[model samples]
Target chain A: MRTAFIKSLMSLAERDPRVWLLTGDLGYSVLEPFAARFPERYMNMGVAEQNMAGTAAGLALSGKKVFTYSIANFAVTRCLEQIRNDICYHNADVTIVATGGGLTYGTQGYTHHGIEDIGFTRLLPNISVVVPADGYEVDLAMGSISGRSGPSYLRLARGGEPVIHTKPIDQSLFGRALMIRPASDVAILSTGSILGEAVAAADRLTAEGIKTGVYSVPVIQPFDAETVAALARQCSLLVSVEEHVTQGGLGSAVAEVLSGLDNPHARLERAGVVHGISPNAGSHAYLRQLHKLDANSLVERIRKISNLSAKRSVKIK
Target chain B: MTAATQTSTSLARRIRSHALRMTHAAKASHIGSCFSMADILAVLYGGVLRFDPSRPDWPERDRFIQSKGHAAAILYAALAETGFFPADWLSTYSCDGSRLGGHVTGHGVPGIELSSGSLGHGLSVACGMSLALRADKKASRVFTLLSDGECDEGSIWEAALFAGHHRLDNLVAIIDYNKIQSFGSVANVLDLEPFADKWRAAKWSVVEIDGHNHDALHKNIGHMPLEAGKPSVIIAHTIKGKGVSFMEGQLAWHYKSANDEQLAQALTEING
Candidate 1:
């Protein structure tokens, strides 16, 4: 995913002279191509995230399309106020790029985890919150927001994420949920890098004679409210899953929309890292398994919810 | 062009008077902060900056970021009088539906480079602007006005170090060393003693001056690149609430707004 981002960004830079990249001493091997090609537009802003964010605002204020890159924790949490006051307050044209979204840097420890970034950046006004699912999605998101005005947070997974899209995705269609498999009875909506697992869950549920729909929602803020509402009306049961905290990420966004409806009928349940920060360190897959975010665990939870709702419906009849 | 057309003393007085009326009508605080930096704003707006009110967004215009944004009254006063907007807008300050927010806002408010109420962010943004100009080979400079109390922020020193390392000669930071901050005196709260030495050690060209001294400011600021290839910082020694006799050096004024009678007294004194 990171590789795809760099490739897309470099092409954007070549096309637009105003595109400037500032990294907080990260992206060592990945960002050299841009630096080599457009040295005037590239800035390694040292280890200061606050200064880097402010600098991105300054550059953007001066008619430059600025992108500040770093690990998710450093990029989002460290200089949050800079993002708030300098970028969002001014509504400067800047993109805050956070590589290693979620626990993509797991085993490196809890400090590197990006569990809370989506929730926080989503709360900031005048900023877009995007969590691209894979490399292809990365290209789609970059192409869309690289030129768009106003600040945005692009939460990227670490490189080598599965190629989710088969062909070039259009800009307008990127923010809305994409259906991996369309079925009517139960719809499984997932976000971030966990979309691949959602596709797998849909496949397994279909084999068991359970008709399910799978969707990948990359944009968290200004989330596809219309689609969420339509999906709620269409399905009997809705399950929202993610590789982030359940409170303010994909699940919370979906729940907020569903709850506000004029007495919607879809039964809603959420699956995420609900136990809070883990004391023990683990890899990405191990942590997903522990958090019940893996395909097998998600399938079990979906089946349980589907069966329980089925029993309730039979009782009603 | 050598000295500002509007005498600095007169501009300073107008700022204080406008602030007295604005704060009194709005019942807002930070009157001390506005008074402390009134003279500095006067000097900057008094022919020191390369900008036009008609073309506030001119690409070549010098950038100014007010880091200590609580003093929005004085900034609005300067912008209004200098033709950025109608002086009538001064009456609308801190009022709802007015472009002049209690804290500085950039949107719809002409002549403001960036909106800042957060203490430590303006310098870094100024540094970024300076860096961009240098990269683009533009002659425009970036200036940021900071409060002494704001130095307590680690982000300030981070920006200081960055400016030095980048050798952003096009950047200038003027610290309103008015002694007092919100909680207490700057010294009692957080000592920025040896402040000049700190900037010098960080590879900055430091100049200590009386913030109210118009001649010194015009001479020093007009003379750019204080030392070639290094950022310049002016530690302008000033008094909190400098203009009004009753308010000068008083910590209460930091959070106290002028009452009707007090406003009358302040405006009377400032008329001179």
Candidate 2:
């Protein structure tokens, strides 16, 4: 995902002379291509995230399409005020690229986790919060973000994650949810790099004679409410999945939309990290399992919900 | 005083008088802050800044950002007196639905580069603008005026270091060292005594001057880039609430909006 972001940014810089990149010194090996190709437009802004964000806004104010890069919270949380006042208020043409979203850096401890970034960024006005499911989505997101003239937050995980889409992704479908499977009994709506887990859980559920559908929602803000509502109508149970905390991430976003509907067809269930800091130190897989974010845990949770719903229907009859 | 100094001094008096009335009418604060930077704004808007009032968005015009945004009264007065908009707009300052708010904003107002009520944001933004102008090979320069109390913010130094390292010679920072802050004196709160040294050590060319002296302001600011390869910072020592005898050097004026009698007295002193 990180590799895809850099390649897309490099292509953007080559085409637009106004494209500039500023980093808080976190992109080590991945950003070399961009830095090497456009030395004049690239700047390593030292360990100061505040300065990098403010400078990005300043550059954007001067008619440059700027991107500020750093890892996780450093890119969004550290200089949040700058993003709020300097960038979003002015409607500057800047994209904030946050790498290592969620528990991708689990071994690095909770400090590196970007659990609350989506919540913090989505509240700001004039900013599009995009959490791509895979490398293909990242490319499509890059094209969409650069084509527009406003602020955007691109949350990416580490590279070498499984690519979910087999064929070419349509650029027009960048901000909309892409359905990987059709729904009959249950549907799983997933966001960010956790889409792979949702797909796996769906396959497992399907084999168990419980038909399930999966939809990958990459854009969390300006959410595809129509698709989500359509899915809710089709399925009896709608489950929202993400690698972030359940409070303000994708789960909460989907819930907010569903709660407003006149007659909600599906019972919404959210699968995400529990709210609070993790006490144990481990790898990505361990953390995911502990938080019930892994495919196995998701499969188990959905089966339980399905069984409970079936029993409730019998009671109603 | 030369003719130019007389003109700027007159402009400064108008800014102070307008600010006094605007604050009193709106029941707003920061009159002292407005007085401290009045002369600097006068000299800059008088002739030093390369801007045409008719063309506020001119590509080649020099950009000025007021980082000490609480002094919106005087900034709006300056813009109005310089014909960015009608001087009549001064009456609507800080009123409900007015474009002129308590803090400086550029939302609907002309001649404002960035909206700032938060300290430590202006210099970094100025550094960015300077870099962009340089990149485009445009000769336009960027200048930002900051308050001494506002320098306490860490983001200011972050930008200071960035500007020096990047050799953003197109940027100029002017500090209104008025000695007073929100709760107490700047010295009692946080001493920036070694302020000029800090800026110099960061590779910027430092200059110290009386902020109220229009001649000094014009002489120093009319010239570009104090050094060939360094950003410039001018530390202008000023008195809070300078023009009015009753209010000069009084810390209370920082948050005190003048009553009708006080406004009359201040207006008399400014006109005198």
Candidate 3:
């Protein structure tokens, strides 16, 4: 995903002279292509994320499209005010690229976790929160983010995540959800790199005779409410999945929408990391399993929710 | 003093007068913050900046960012006095639905490059503008005004280091060293005693001056790039609530809005 981001950004920079990249000294091997190609437009802003974000806003305000890069929380939480006031309030053309979203850096401990980034960024006005699920989605999201004039937060996982879309994905699906499977009894709406786990979970659920659907929501803000609502009406249970915390990420967004809908059919189940920082450290797979975000865990959680909802319906009858 | 210097001095007086009235009318604070940097705004808008009132978005115009954004009253006054907007607009400052927010904002106000009230955000942005202008090879300069109290923010030094390292020669930072902060004196709160040394160590060319002196302001700021291949910082020593006798050097004025009686007294001293 990191490789995809730099490649897409490099192409955008090449096409538009206004595009510039500023890093908080996090991108080492991944960003060299951009730095080597656009030396004048690229700057390693040292270890200061606040200065980097402020500088990105300054550059954007000066008619330059700016993107500031750093690992996970450093790109969002560290310079949040700068992003809020300097970038978003001013409506500067700045894209904040936060790599290592969620447990991708689990081995590095909780300090490196980006589980709460979407929660903070989605609340800010005049900014788009885009959590792309794979390398293909990153390319598609870049096209949408760069074409817009306002601020955007591009939350990406670290490199080597497989592209889930075997078919050609349309650029128009950038702000909307792309359905991987048709809805039946239950639907799973996933975002970010966790989409792979969601797809795997859907396949297992389908084989178990409990038909399931999977939708990849790349853009969290300006959320695809229409599709989510339609799916809610079709599926008896709608489960929202993300690598981020349940409070302000994909689940919270879906919950906020569903709660407001008149006569919403389906019951929503939020699946993600529970609130509060974790003390345990392990690999990405280990942490995902611990948080019940792994494919098998997700399948188990969904089956339990479906059965409970089925029992409740039978009681109503 | 030259004609320009005299005009700047008068401009500074007008800024102080307007600030006193605006703050009093809106029942707002930061009058002390406004008065301290009145001369800096006056001199910049008076002559140093190359901007046309009609063309606020002129591509080649120099950019001015008020990093110490609480001083909005004075900055708006400076813009109004220089014809960026009608001087009558000064009366609406900080009022409900007024464009003149308590903190300096560029939302509807012309001549403001960036909105700021939070400390330590301006210089880094100024560095960005400077870099952008340099990249475009445009000669337009970027000037940002910061307060001594505001310098207590760590982001200030982060930007200071960035500007110096990048050799953003087109950028100039003018620190309004009024010596007072929200809680107490900057010294009593958090000392920036070796302030000038800090900028010098960051690879910037440093100049210390009296912030309220128009001649010194024009002499230093009117010239560009105090040194080749380096950003310049002017540590302008100033008095809080300057031009008003009672309020000057009084920390109470930082949060105290002038009453009807105090406003009259302040106006008399300012005009006198």
Candidate 4:
């Protein structure tokens, strides 16, 4: 995903002479092309996130579309005030490309985890919060944000993430959720790199004679509330899956949308990292399994729910 | 009307008149700071900055951030004097729901480049603006006017180090060293003595001048690019209350606002 985003940024630089790329000294090899091609336009702001955000705002104020790249936590949290005052207040055309969107940096521990970024940024007005599911979606998001005005936060995974969008992603046709596979009995609302797990769960459910419709919501801030509600009404059961904390991640956003509307029949369940850190430190894959954010766990949980529902129907009869 | 005396006297008269009127209307303080920095603001808006009042967000306009933003009346006077907004807006300053609040805001005003009340943040924002212009290969400069007491902020030092590290020559910071903060004397509060040496030590080319002397102010600004590969700091020494005789050199004015009678007297003194 990092490779795709860099390539997309390079492409943007080629097209728009006004695009300036700034990094807080994080991208050494990944940003070489931008640094080499447009030395004047590319800057390594040297580990100062506040300065990077302010500089991005300044560039935007000067009529240039600016993008700042940094690791997830430093990129968003460190300079949040700058983002709020300089960029959001002015409504500057700046895109904060935040890499390492969740436990993608798992072994690196809690400091590197980007779980709360969406929650924090979602509260801000006039700033679009985007979480692209895969590399293809990252490319689509780049196109979606180009020639766009106002501020945006793009949460991205680090390099070597699986690709999910098998074909071209037309951003206009895309809502917060995309129905990857259709289902009538249950609906799965999934986000981020956890889409692979949700997909596997859906496949397992289909084998068990339960039709599942999976919706992928990439844009989390100005989420397609209309689509989420519509999908919620279509199924009796709605389950949200994310590789983020349950507090305000994709689950919370989806639940917020579902709570107010006319979805009385909808039984909602959310699957994500609950509160608290892991006791042991290991690779991200081990962490994913420990948190039950993997496919097998998701499938087992859904199967158990399905059995409970069957018993409840017999009790009603 | 030679540039030096004409700009000084005209701006001083406007500053005194407006400062008296704004504070009188709102019954607010910051009158002392306004009076002290009036000449400096005059020198900046009248002479140095490249801005178009007609187009507030003009792409090439030189950026100005008032780090000591509590003196919105000064910037308000400067902006109105420059025709950025109507001169009538001065009357509504600090009124209920007025855009011209006690501190500077970019919401309704055009010439206000950044919203500032937080002192140390402005220099950092200005430094970033300069870095951006350099990165974009634009020649426009950024000038931030700071109060002497604001130099005590750690964030200011962070920005100072950054400006020097980046060698941001296009960035020019001028300190309105009136030597009074919200508390008592900056000396009593926290001494920023040897302040010019502080900037010089931080790798900024330092220029010291009488902040009120239009000739000195203009001369120092005239020598832009003060040093290659270094940001420039003009430490303009000024008084707390410069033009108003009753308010001059008194720390109490920093907090106390004039009554109706004092307003009448100030108006009389300013016009006279």
Candidate 5:
């Protein structure tokens, strides 16, 4: 995903003279290609996130399209006020790229985790919050990012994530969710890099003679509300899946959409990290299992919400 | 002194007088702040800043941001008196439905660059402005005026370091070092005594001047990029409450609005 994002960024810079990239000194090997190609456009803004954000806003204010890069919270939360006042208040043209969304850096402890980034960034006005599912979506998002006139937040996991989309993604589908599978009245709406678990959950339900709607929503902030509302009408229950807190992530956004609907039978269930910080730390897989955010967890949560008696936990296979 | 320099001095007096009346009417604070930077503002808006008041958004115009934005009355006065708007607009300052609020905002107000009130934000934003201008090969410069007390914020140091690190020679910072702050003296609250040294450490070409001296203010501010490849910072040491006799060096003036008698006396002192 990092490779694809950098390649896309290089191409965007190559095509447009207005494109400029600033980093908080976190991009080591990942950003070399662009830095080597366009040394003038690429800047390593030390480790000062606030300064980086302010400079990005300044650049954007001067008619340059800026992309500020850093790992996780450093990119978004560390300099949130700069993003809020300097960038968003002026409505400057800058894209904030946050690598390591969610628990991609699990072994580095919870502090390195970007669990609350999307939730925090989602509250700011005039900025788009995007969480791409894979490398293909990352490439597509990079292409669309330059065309976005206002500030935007691009959420990505650390490099080497699996590719979920098997084919080319159209530009029109950039801000909208995609349905990869068609099965039942129950819909599993997943966001971020956790779409793999959702896809597997849909398959689990399909084998059990239950049709499930699997949608991968990459753009989380300005979500496809009309489509979600349209999907809400067909499904008995809508389950929001994310690798973030249930309060303000994809789940809360989907719940907000569900709340505005007048459908009598529509029910919304959110599956995300609801507990306090994880007491046990290991790998991403270990953490996901401990928090019950894996595939089986989604299948169980979906069944519980849809009035279907979920099979015994051990006998799921 | 030349005619323009004499005009700048007189303009400074008018700014102080106007600020006194506005602060008295609106019952707003920061009158002390407004008075301290009056001469510096007069010099900049008088003729030093490369600008046309009618063309507030001109690309080539040198950008000036009032980072210590609580002093909106003086900024508005400087703009209005210079014909950015009608001088009549000064009467509506800080009033309900008025474009001129107590804290400076720029969306509707002409001649203002960025809407600002928060300390330590303006310099970095100005640095950004300078960085972009240099990148575009535009000769336009970015100037920011901050407060001594506002330097207590960590972000100010961050911005200073950033401007220095980037070699933002197109950028300039003027600190309104009035020796006084909100709660107490700047020394008592947060000692920035080695302030020039600190700026020098950040790689800025530092200049110390009496902020109230019109000739000194004009001479220092009119110039650009004091040295090659370095941002310039002018530490204009000033009095908190300037112009008015009773208000000078008085901390009470920081928050106090003038009574009728005081306003009369203040205006009398300013006119003289």
Candidate 6:
């Protein structure tokens, strides 16, 4: 994910002179090309995130499209008020590229986990929150928002995550949902890097003759309300999946649409991290397993929710 | 520009008159802070601050961020006097649906750069603007005005350290040392004594002068980048209510809104 982001930002910088890159004394090895190519436009504002965000806002006011890159938690959380007042309030054209979304740096401890960024940033008006599903999606999102007006927060996974999209994803479908797999009985709404596990869960359900569809929602805020309403209408039972906590995340966003609907028959179940910190710290894979975000746990949870075994037992004529 | 110096004193007097008129009409307060910074705003709008009333969003225009945003009435007066907006708009201050609120807003006002009411946030924004200007190779300067009490905020130091570390030569910060805050005298509340020393220690080129001195303010604004390679901070010593005799050096005036009679008296005292 980091490699793809660097490649994309470098390409965008080459094309747009207004794009300036700023970091909070981080990005030592990854941001070399941006510095070398756009030396006049690049700045490392040192360890001050508040200043970095404010600086980005100032640059945006000067007709310069700005990008501030740092580890996710530090970039957004530390400068939360500045982002709220300076960028979102003014609708400045600055992209807050927050690397290490979710538990991408799991071993670094609970402080580094960027789990709640979506909850806070997505709530602000005029801010488009993009949670790319994979490297391909991340690359496309970069191209879409480079010179685009208004503020945006690009939540990225650190290191190289698997490239999930087979072909080049259409960059213009920014706020729309993608139907990865289709079904009528149950629709699974997934976001962020956890879509891979969601696909595996759908496969397990399919083997047992249980019909389920996977919906990858990359843009959490300003989600395709029409698509979500249509998906809810297709299924009696709706499930939302994400690596973030159940509070005010992808599940919460989906529930917002479902709760307001005239249809009272659709029941919603959410699969995500619950309250409480992870007991042990380890790599990203280990943390996912510990938190029951793996394929097996997702399958078991879905099985319990749908009661598919009993349905399978009643054989068709 | 000679009109700037010739009419600057009267312009400063007009700012005080407008502050009294606006605050009384709106039934709001902040006359003291407004009076204190009148001459500074006068010098800025009249002499320094390269701005055009016609093109408020001009890219190369010099930037001004008022950290002590409570003194917004004075800014509105100066901006209106310079034809940024109609002087009649000052009547709607603090009224419902009025853009001229008690605090400065960037929405309706021209020449105003950013929306700021939060103290200690302006310097950081100004530093950011200065950094961006350098990156663009534009010689535009950024001027930030802060109150004495606002320096108590930790974010101010964070911004000060950053400006020094980056060697932001295009940034200039002026501290409106009115010696009084909402509670009481700033010295009795939080001592910024050794304030000049502190800025000097932080690698800034420090200049201390009477904030109301028009010529001094004019001279310093021209001689900015005080040193060849440093950010500059001007410590402008001022009376809490410089022009008005009744409000001068009185902390109670910070919260006391003027009634009809008091407003008349304030106008009369400032006019002559």
CA deviation > 4 Å runs, candidate 6: A308-317, B1-3
lDDT of 2: 0.91
Q: Which is the leading candidate under DockQ?
A: 3
lDDT per residue for candidate 6 within A81-138, as digits (tens), equals: 8898888988889889988888788898788888888888988879989898898788
* Residue A173 of model 4, lDDT score: 49
Q: What TM value does model 5 have? A: 0.95
TM-score of each: 0.97, 0.98, 0.98, 0.91, 0.95, 0.94
- Runs of candidate 4 exceeding 4 Å displacement: A263-265, A311-317, B1-3, B27-29, B58-60, B132-139, B152-155, B183-194, B241-256, B268-272
DockQ score for model 5? 0.73
Worst ten-residue run, lDDT, model 2 chain A? A308-317
* Cα lDDT for residue B233, candidate 2: 95
Give candidate 6's error at residue B158 in angstroms: 2.7
**Model 6 chain B worst lDDT run, 10 consecutive residues:** B1-10
Per-residue accuracy of model 1 over A31-91 as CA lDDT, tens digit each: 9998999898888988999999998889888888999999998999999999998998788
TM-score of chain B of 1: 0.97
- Tens-digit per-residue lDDT, A1-317, candidate 4: 87888899989889998888889889767889889998888878777887778778877877788889998889999888788888888888999998888888888888888888988788877888888888887877788788578899998987776777789877684445777888577888888777887888899888888777787878887888888887777777788888788888888988898778763556778888865857546577877787788888888877788788877731111
lDDT at position B129, candidate 4: 81
Q: Give the Cα lDDT of each candidate.
A: 0.88, 0.91, 0.90, 0.83, 0.85, 0.83
Any residue pairs clashing in model 1, and if so which? Answer: none
Q: After best superposition, candidate 2 residue A245: deviation in angstroms? A: 1.4
Candidate 1, residue A13: Cα displacement in angstroms equals: 0.6
Model 3, B1-272: lDDT tens digits are 89999899888888889999999999999999899888888899889999988999999999999999998999999999888999999999988899999999889898889999888899889989999999999999999999998888889999998889889999999999999999998998999989899999999999999998888999999997899899999999999999898989999999999999999999999988
In model 5, residue pairs whose N, Cα or C atoms come closer than 3 Å (at least 3 residues apart or on different chains), thus clashing, are: A183-A211, A183-A212, A184-A211, A184-A212
In order, the first chain's TM-score in every candidate is 0.96, 0.97, 0.97, 0.95, 0.94, 0.94
- Tens digits of per-residue lDDT for model 6 on B134-252? 87788779999999999998778878988888789899999999999889888899998899999988899999998988888888976678986799999999998877777899987
Q: What DockQ does each prediction reach against the true complex? A: 0.81, 0.81, 0.90, 0.47, 0.73, 0.62
lDDT of 2 by residue, B88-111 (tens): 999999989999989999998999
Model 4, docking class = acceptable
How far residue A77's Cα lies from its native spot in candidate 2, in Å, is 0.6
Better of 2 and 3 by DockQ: 3
